[model samples]
Target: MTSTFPILTPAGVRRILLDRKEIALIDVREEDPFAQSHPLWAANFPLSKLELDAWPRIPRRDTPVVVYGEHDGVDLAPRAAQVLRALGYTSVHLLEGGLAGWIAAGGETFRDVNVASKSFGELVESKRHTPSLSAQEVQVLLDAHADAVVVDARRFDEYQTMSIPTATNVPGAELVLRVRELAPDPATRVIVNCAGRTRSIIGAQSLVNAGLPNPVAALRNGTIGWTLAGQKLDRGASRRAPADVTAINRARAQSGARDIAAKAGVRRIAYAELASLDAPGRTVYRFDVRTPDEFAAGHFPGFVSAPGGQLVQETDHNAPVRGARIVLADDDGVRADMSASWLAQMGWEVWVVDPVDAGLRSETGTVGHPAPEAEAVATITPGTLAGWLNDPKENDVAVLDVTASANYVKRHIPGAWFVIRAQLQQALEKIPSARRYVLTCGTSQLARFAAADLKRLTQAEVAVLEGGTQAWIEAKLPLEEGETRLAVPRSDRYRRPYEGTDNATEAMQAYLDWEFGLIAQLERDGTHFFNVV
Candidate 1:
């Protein structure tokens, strides 16, 4: 049966991209499968967590949203469309014939997470000719204990996970701000690395753009290249950049950041001008480029926490609104100014707000917008659901665990059917008859999205389990293991060959080859307006 939502051909979507129209090309498949192949502009909008992620990812409900799935019998695009319509999305359509149609229409597809930004990073390096030192050369420098410091541009946890010997956790945004403290002497060399190529390249180029006195270079290919070359990585290392940034260093960072930002054409907006950016119907993302700890200590109200380095590395994950205006804020002006430089080069209309006003709030803790309200649905407590399971009167009560198949196989309520939330209606036909159905997931947030769908499909008394599987575990409940009761296969999360040390050498090499080929793909697509100073 054809969907009432019009079918958008791949050529039509391609034209939209070429014409630079605002579009949300959404792929409703799980991340892993979607990573294997997708249009360059398509963002993953998995069916399972549509309610939670869609509002922020696709801000304008009326934005042209073209959704696609595998086109197999189990495709989730149709179900996803229903959910989007329910969520009040005004304009929604499906990609005709799904991903296959895109390939058939000569649309370029990309692999790996954040492919767009990764390719752009490669372009930046190619254009600016970022400097780098290979693993062998870096090892020689480390052996000699030269006047050089290696800065891990990744998050602290990743540095803790694995790092080069004597590397400090400067993160990405901190590099430009704290480099003077780490390597005070102008002659000291600075080296930066991430798990892979992008952060290292960006970090090195940042200092070059800032006109820092020290010689800077990215550790070629980052940790992956090091491991491939048989260099030993230190695990559980916890060295951090110096805590107190000197006043002289602060002034230097600010001056340098301002100069670089000016060259990149980044903007600065005062609080009053920011008011217009906040008016309704405009898509503006405010980010505090400070560290999580700093933001928690005090930050402007309504700003999301996106530490500078990680924001540059994970632009797709943090800000999916490509054409949306972005405003970055920081107290010292160094962090936000430096970060805004990169974002501006990446084609974002970015602004840096000098955050010295009385409006800065000291609300200490994690900050985020309140989640959009979910539809009204009946729910049962974990303890109550347990009682219902044991009751003789309700012996026919059935459980549908809407978590990923991988999680289900790890631990699940005994006799619970592992299902994809959006596929609940189709799965119900094959499930055993029940007087009532209880839906659950890791936290039950996604279960709410499935509750109405289940009720509509089964017409049976459907209710979500409060607190989900986690709440059940807290109740000292027993769990079943194995892949015995599954309505959905585990295909959501991609297992990157480059991520862990356990992958076969061939697979890792293949991953590197794929990354190397992205430059050509970018040329073929030719839409990303990436510039490097």
Candidate 2:
């Protein structure tokens, strides 16, 4: 009889390693055994941490996971595989002979590698190598007339509570995207700091890796370290102009108001025009860009809640229509206008509509209780879906599996690609343009977001698999079993590394020249493909 399960040998594991497959070689031995040695990159998800943190970080569900442990009559691999399979991972496999087999096979073992220690070490090494100036040093630099810019890499709340008087808060993740906005000058020294060290280390290293012309450094050990060294720490938030109102407006002006306005290409459409564009066969999205609480308070029927900033940042993920007309509803125009401006810059077709103007009831009717807007993007109905499934055309069909990787592995709609909702935008290129796409998730909420976003970004014919995968199974549709491979987009590779005070005019001009030319150099060296994220 043919065996239903496969036991992977050390040779098989080696092949996976060479190919860089996403296989986790788990050592299920007790703490004492694990403390002796483990494979490189092999994290000890100790049987203890298994149910808690280990399962969450396993990037893919269908991944060929290999488990091993001590041999002496103790077969932990089998039990581990069973648990993983119970967790809905369909492809759990046991290492042929556990750690003993690996040793006999002459496999290498790593000593003294733990996640926490490695992370801390990386933090320390980064600080030791990167340049940094203390508060006193910064004062001295100012006294000596040296050109430098200081930036605070902390959350907005922390920045508001306390920060260096001369530093500006540019949150860590936003640093790369907003770097050019912060420092236009290349000649000025760029200094980064956080409350302690980790953020500063990572932030400073980011600039260094990005090949910034200006010298970048962390404020050694950050604010605490500086204060401990008999130096002063600036308290109370810096009195700076609001970023949204002042900085954004200034940036718009510099980019050229006429040019920006032209690029925005905003058109005010009447309710009649909006209705004219709506068709039975076409997918349309109506968004209420307001807080969730406000949306729950009262909103137009059929409108879904997607806050303005998040909607813009995740436009490609939330609304994928490249040229899909978007109608945004908000009681006030400020939030809508701001969101529309950013969306336009990112190459989206967007329109802001006043909820009251569209014959919608006033939210004032409800005092305490609120509900999600009654308006939802018109989606495919079960009858229409059944009809499509019966005669599904190759040209007008696409299927997206939005379930977690593990769930998708156990069973999913045939031909549906596993698309992580968070990474949907980056996976756009992998999606085919030939057919209408159908999105399925554990529930309909994520499916709606996926379907709406896909329709908007790709402008491809789209539909949500009614009732998601659950309904698909209930209808007895054919199911396919396989592991899902994540699609990573080219744009997702580019990461920003610097966040500092606005550079001096001379430094700004110099840096711009360097950056413009570096792209060509990177391409010539054939190393431009490297990206942080």
Candidate 3:
């Protein structure tokens, strides 16, 4: 097929990065394959999720976008570019020769997701020489009942999965704010850990940067290290920082975090300054560095809820435009400044919305990306669809679920075939042809987009389920478990070696070794504008 998009060479991309111009280097493949190898700054969009994620992740329609995907004899770049163009993206281009072309040009490639963020963590440790205690040493403190406190810096769910014994779940951004309360005595030893190296290093460094009076150190290599030392981890742990923040502790935290943020050159901006960042040729990302529940209750109208810990751990996914301006917001004085401080050191022109006005938080509930305007497809209610499926005459209608493969396996409408939106056309060959087809997803948002693609492939009457599978379940309809019917291979999520307890000891050690060497990789890449403070 003749290519509709122009080609962008590796040299061209290097120039853009060096010049600090905004560009979205997107890898349009499944996350599992994309995690194996790609450019350091490239974000995984996955062709299957283009419509669902494009508008939110790559906000600007005209932002320079270079896409590439070639794995297992499948070339998805051209197809993805076509989809981008059709979605009104004006400046889409294909990478010259894809990943191989970049390699031939001496461009660096990195393994695993969020390579940029992980590399920066290593850079921070190398420059600052962050303090640490070996897993064996920490275990001794626990066994002797010493006056030491262990805090898990990963997300609560991860801590719940497996954590150090008696460790409180105080995530990265919360370390500065909550640690003083957790370990009240200045003489108390404070230990921070995560599943792997990044969060542990960053979390421990955060306290040191904040000038915490207590002796602070990272659990060397985190839970992975503990397991390697033949130590058992605690499962289903629920220990967490207390909910209430006393006025005195809150004031101390605010003062310390602000000082650190200033040292790192993070700007404290008012709401009025946001408009200036909206100028052409610039991409600005506004995020609320608060917990998901807090955000769901009420949040700044335009800001997305990205908890501070995960935001720093997954910057490439959160803000793909490498040189983009980031504005963070938090009602509490500590989280935004603490998060912004790390972002500033990572070479982002970041700002914290100082004194975030409560009145501006008019929006409430979980906000999804604005639904794109598409040709209206016919809709079928859950009750009516169930009646039709029960009737032999109307059972000819094909039900297609376009939700994530992981979610589909957990629970889905009984007999609904799981399909990848990107593979909808090819998958049609496997699905039996029907007089009419009804598409559904978690909430029918992705399904609505898939309906347009399905229309192009077949003349069959196409419709979307009203409210999708969730509605079916709410209507007291029976749901099926497991992958009962599959139109495409289940390869959406990449399993990380550092997550869970079943990983091989060698794989975990290799992962740590890879991270230990990222500082050298960063130097060779020469495009990362990191300036560790």
Candidate 4:
């Protein structure tokens, strides 16, 4: 029997692009062909891996799914439609004439390996997705003292070099995981931006997808657009309290206090009782809620390094067990208390474990220094860092770069390697250690976190770059930059489709039935799909 869905002309898809409706454009093509070029906003789910775990990643079954492929006998669209329908997707459809038709219809394409990137761009234009205010809008908000949080979703280094004056760095992919920590006030409007559009768009959408209560928007076009509009962007760090710390503390305090617990319907633990849970056999996470640099400078043994803000963002990733006990430690109680509060609300057993004892406080409120050996941790000064360039001695030094991928690609100090903060713990082996280990980022904040983590996991002496790579640069250290292929695995490319004996049977039947019924729906709903013999 013939299918009922109408063949969507290129014009129809174009209109959808302009309208910004919540639809997914899927390109079923091999990786190499897709990397060469594909329409903007289209995501490639190669035919090979389509049957794997593609469906779960797609949040909604009823949401419109448009499928296409290069013009060839491969005819993967129909097969994809079948699998989607069998999996209970109600609105799967094919693109007419596939990519060839899209090009003929004047659609824009990108050279990126993933089609999802292009579709993401299309999502921005179509949804008329609310973008963060321009630099002018920010200026107005500043003048008015409006309750808005401007987040610089770039690498810490980029933020250090230049950013929206009032903006704080929170890296894009990290935001969804960290949103609750970054903006505890449900009333605060959260605005995310990057140096350019991609990360901003992805970051804002991630919050929306996660169903955060806060109103989230992207800074339109980002810093580039802001500067192009003749508006000034913030350069250099501000003296204001770090937004991450502030938000984290607020959330923690609220969660820890009995009154707030009564409101959020959660519980909190005492400091001593929490310490009791730290014994062996239990997977305990002791988090140091200080700037990465400060954490690197020195910290309590066995504490995982997490800047309070990033700790909140990546709590689940770092501490997957919702029931795991978390001990929050910081030089001061401010950040620890704050992070503890949020963790409590998230249903984690949390405590603000003070590094110093109460008796010590009575005698002298001064914190004790780490052991002298800890003080002797080997670190690379700008002057000595150059020696490691070619004939560097293996000093058991571990080097890590915690900056965003894009910035790391732009330029990085020699012998330094990149690791997304979230993935640092998992990828710890990448760093070679012979002497003392040093962690670096665009700023000392990330380095501090990494150094602390190294100390917790190993007995090695650890230090953070004094000011991170930025300080190294200021010291006039030699730098290197060029295309260096990241050996990291692509999470998106790796997927496994659901498989079962009843799967193909049910899938094939659902496929044919959907194809036949789609034509009728097209006439009634005015939706479109591709047609091929």
Candidate 5:
């Protein structure tokens, strides 16, 4: 039976990309499989998370979207397209032949996530010859107590997990503004590093671009390189940049960042321009590029928080839609300008929102957009579920957790079985039948959809945990840890070689080799509109 939804060839998608139009090339498979191989610009929008993620990720209903997926002979693309249509998305199409079709058409595929931004980082280094110091050289400097400071450009949590000796955490966006405080002397050498190469290169180049007086360099290949060079990394280190920036340093940083942003062709937009950019056909993403705590304190009404450093490191995950217009906001002048400079160079039509009255940032607390609603599903409070679980014989119930597999392994209800929502029916075949079933995830939102799905698959009674696993923990309920019972394989997240202390030497070297070759890959692909200023 041939399908009814409109079909797009790999060539058609490429044409749209070349034309610089808005097109979402979505891979509707779990991240593990999608990370194995995907077209250069394809964003993973798993079928299991389609309803929960679609609205926020692809906000414009009529934006051209091409979905493709296949796992264990299960064709998920058509199903994903249908779900998009039901969510009020008017322009949804399936990629002809899916991943296989793209390969057959000679389309370039990339391994690992965020290849677009990672490759761009390599391109930036190639074009600019970004300065860097090998782990061994940096180690020599540290051993000699030279006039140098190592700034880890990753998130604080990553720094805490593993860091270079005598390194301080000053995430990428803060490098230009905070480096002065970290190394007060203009002659001090500043070394920036991350788990791997991208953030390290970008962080170092940012200072160079800002024309910082200090001599700066990235730690070549970051911690991975350190490990490869037989150097030890410090664990549980909490060194950080000072909280306060000197007025003079702040002024210099602001001027420098703005100059670089202008060089990269980033526009400074007034708040009123947001409405025009967000007009019907256009998809505009408004983001607050400050720290998470700063964003939680206050933010623009329509903007969500995306820390500037992580935003650049994970542009594909943050924006997804190629060619979408992005507006970044920050109370301080430097962060947003610095972040926008990189986005502009990445070929996005990016703008930094001009400073507004403090009164405009009145919204308090972290941004958490609830997934769009589906038909009402019955709900059970965490307390009520606890009572039922205490004596299961009479209650005759089964609990299914639909959260990420990794999260499920960390903590979950004492006896709930981990299951993939997309494989719910197949998983049902393995679980013993029960009179009643309860579903849960990180929040009850995803579980609510899963409950509705379960109701259709069986005649059994179905309900969602009122507040999901978080609420269960808050209720002081007993919890189980580790992969207790799994009805489906854990294929949700792809483990990156750059993460954690335990990884094969071979894998780390392979990851580095892959990144080393990305500049050539970018040229062969030819869709990236990157320009290094």
Candidate 6:
């Protein structure tokens, strides 16, 4: 069954993503490895969390899914296909030759998460010549305590972790909507920044696109640039965006956003009109573009929570079906209006749904989707398993820790074999024989998914650790570290040279150099319709 699966070439997959069609090009390896190298638009769908995530990530069972993995003697695409099929996915296939084949076919590969967003940021800068200031220049403004407001466009937590001295926390989506309030005096210069380039560029440009009067510029390369420039960074800063925007400023932003959106041919849809627009032969994606906290406070039903800033930055991740119609909802029209403008220019048929109407609304957790049911797999808790380990003669349990290689190396249950969830069939040969096989991961979701594979491949009783390794830690059990024993190679993960504490200066510069070249790649591909107002 594995060998008989149909294959998709690298060139074919590239065209699919470039065309913005409904096909999901999935990288089945763990996230860290996928970050090292992969096609520009490919989404990481690790085999570890397939069952728990597949249903929600790829809702339509029949949506074309193409899975691939590391080609270094560890091919997981076939095994991933089996799991997808078991979950009732009608159309599933493999990427021919895997990562190597994609490289061979001359497809553009990018490192790091949110490649599409970063590439778009580069494109926006290339086309619009969005204003920017180097780390040195921004530092000068701050030192002088000039009439300038440095707005960190990253999440509040990231801002608190490390930030440019005296930057306020107005995230990307909120910038245009509340900038006037942040800098009521039009003369106050607004400088936007992120951990790196993408959000900074997008945030600064968002204000420009919205036609803000304040002088705006992105911190040349953000915190990374700031550190590299030998500037001091503030830690544990608690600055936040303005408490409220003035009424006049709100009306101006809403009015300006409407004009910008109109230029992209974006439509304004009433709450009731949403039903009529859900026509046959069209996939309608409903999204609420507000703060994660606000969305959890109160939001309409049947809509996924995608912040406006993140939705635009990771459009392919949020809406893989490129041509699908997208409807964005928000309490204030500014976020929805501003976000829809970007989506429209990106070639989506976009609309804004008024969120003021009282509809069937749900407010609870941050996540929109429910966990998938794994009825076939039995479960055991960390404490019960600890008691079983205490039994001397009845010790017949063989554990397979299917967590990421990095996590496994740090700590794991004593005598557990670290294995990839997809490679369980072959991994069975390497582990010790036992009366029962147990599976585990960071959160136990992957363990549950792997449990089904263990049951199918062997007659031994297979059970998943209920809360996984985290539960074990909380249970106060001892853990063993290092790669002393393993059923799988550590090839599933790729150590990023540009990340971590000890990165060499040249490598950081090289990373930035590569990002600088993405604009040319976009020019060569001619697919991204990045229109700047």
Number of the top-ranking candidate, with TM-score as the measure: 5
Among the numbered candidates, top lDDT falls to 5
How many residue pairs clash (N, CA or C atoms closer than 3 angstroms) in each of the candidate models, in the order given?
A: 2, 27, 0, 39, 0, 0
lDDT of the structure predicted as candidate 6: 0.81
Structural RMSD, model 3: 2.1
Q: TM-scores of the models, in the given order?
A: 0.90, 0.36, 0.94, 0.35, 0.97, 0.88
lDDT of candidate 3 vs native? 0.90
Residues 31-96, model 2: lDDT tens digits: 445646555334454442243333333524565667777533656566556556756666767777
Candidate 3 per-residue C-alpha lDDT over 1-533 given as tens digits, one digit per residue, 9 for 90 to 100: 42668999999999999998889999998888889989988999988778767888888889999999985688889988987887778999899999999999999999999899899999988899999999999999999999999999999999999999999999888888889888889999999999989999999999998888899999999999999999989999999898788888888889988998999999988886778779888888999998888898888878999999899999999998778899999998899999999999988999899785688888999877854676688899999889888899897889999898889999998889999887887679899999989999998888998998899999999999999899998899999989999988876778898898899999999999998889889989999999998
What is residue 341's positional error in candidate 5, in angstroms? 1.0
Q: Write the per-residue lDDT of candidate 6 for residues 1-533, one digit (tens) a residue.
A: 56767888877777776666767788888777788888766788777677767776676677788888864486878877988898888778788888888888877677877777788788778788999999999988888999999999887877887888989988888988888987989899999998778889988988987889999999988877887898888888898987688889988888878888898788888887888876754567889899988888778877878989889877867876545788999888899998898888777889998656544455545764656666667889888888888789659988899988889999999988999876776688888789988889998877876787678788888898888999999999989999967897775675443334455767667667878988777676555666655
Candidate 5 residue lDDT tens string, 1-533:
22768899999999999999999999999999999999999999989989988888888889999999999899988878888888988888889899999999999999999999999999999999999999999999999999999999999999999999999999888888888988888999999999899999999999999989899999999999999999999999999999899999999999999999999999988976777777767789999988899898999998998999999999988899998999999987999999999999999999899988888899999877646786799999999899888975646888999999989999999889999998899889888888989999998888988888889899989999998999999989999999898998888889899999999999999999999999888888999999999
- Can you tell me which runs of candidate 5 are displaced by over 4 Å? none
Residue 398 lDDT, candidate 3, scale 0-100: 90
Off by over 4 Å in 3: 1-3, 391-397, 432-436, 459-461
**Looking at model 3, how many pairs of residues clash?**
0
- Please provide, for model 4 over 1-533, each residue's C-alpha lDDT reduced to its tens digit, 9 standing for 90 to 100: 01643356667766764453445677766545565666645666664345433542343456567887752355667766766676677777778778788777766555533222323333333444545566577667767878888877655876766677678777553454455665778889888876555456556655654456788887765665566566666667542324444554444433333332233333344545555765543446666666666655666655556775455544433453223466776554444554454445444556665446534222222233221111233456655555544444644454667665556767878666666443344456655544666667776654654464567777666667777788888988767674243423322232211111122434334332332332333233222221110
List the candidates ranked by TM-score, beginning with the highest. 5, 3, 1, 6, 2, 4
Q: What 10-residue stretch in candidate 1 is worst by lDDT?
A: 354-363
What is each predicted model's overall lDDT from 0 to 1? 0.83, 0.54, 0.90, 0.55, 0.92, 0.81
- Rank the candidate models, highest lDDT first: 5, 3, 1, 6, 4, 2
Query: What pairs collide in candidate 6?
Result: none
